[model samples]
Target: MMSSTFLVMRERVVAAIMSNPVVGPDSAGTLARMNDPSQNCTFEELGFDSLARMEFCIFLETEFGISLSSGEIEASPSINAMAAYLAGEG
Candidate 1:
């Protein structure tokens, strides 16, 4: 089972993905699938191109007060990876 903290973080990431007009609701599922730390589904698999990743960084900054460096995002290419990065676990 995933930790509650990770689940909470996942929900936040899902909400961020769903709220973005540029991303559809289906994107949330893709985000969720890619969020697994064990999976290598990657941001690219969830349709997060470079521009989308930048926008996601902005969203994370605005929503979670987490400012991710470009290198951080590049290294952690999934929602859980990003969450871990933001939570100082990466």
Candidate 2:
């Protein structure tokens, strides 16, 4: 089971992805898919190349006030895993 904190962070993480210009386009279809909780996709599945990953890391650092390496993000690739990892960090 996921903690409340994890669940909330998961939503925020999804929101972050949706807001990412490189990873997510401003398309309704993409937003709909992103909103679907069942669609827990890895960064690769979301078409994240090295540049996108680095940009997202910068975004995360700015948004969460926490520094994370690309390797760390790659390790916890999915939203759920990332959220859990972040919740633990908190």
Candidate 3:
């Protein structure tokens, strides 16, 4: 089971992605991106790409006040999985 806090973070992450013009408000499109084998999602697919990865970390830190490793973030491919990981349930 995931902690309520982590669940909230996942919601925030989804909101963040949706805020991106490229992503927009289409839940289906975001889900497709998550399921794309070529992208393989992970955290790296959060549009981090190396340079942006650090920025993403910073964003998470500033937004959620939680310090997460790139590897930790990358290990989770789906929002639910990420939430579970963040919640320390996985």
- The candidate that wins on lDDT is 2
Stretches > 4 Å off in candidate 3: 1-3, 16-28, 31-48
Compose the digit string of candidate 1's lDDT tens values, residues 1-71. 55667667666665665565454335556554655545434555666666666677678789889776656
TM-score per prediction, in order, is: 0.65, 0.78, 0.56
Clashes of each: 0, 0, 0
Residues 8-75 of candidate 3 have per-residue lDDT tens digits of 76666555454443323235665676443332234544544554445555666777787877676567
State which candidate has the highest TM-score: 2
For candidate 3, which ten residues in a row score worst on lDDT? 35-44
TM-score of 1: 0.65
Cα-based lDDT at residue 4, candidate 2:
83
> Cα miss at 83, model 1 (Å)?
2.6
Candidate 2's clash total is 0
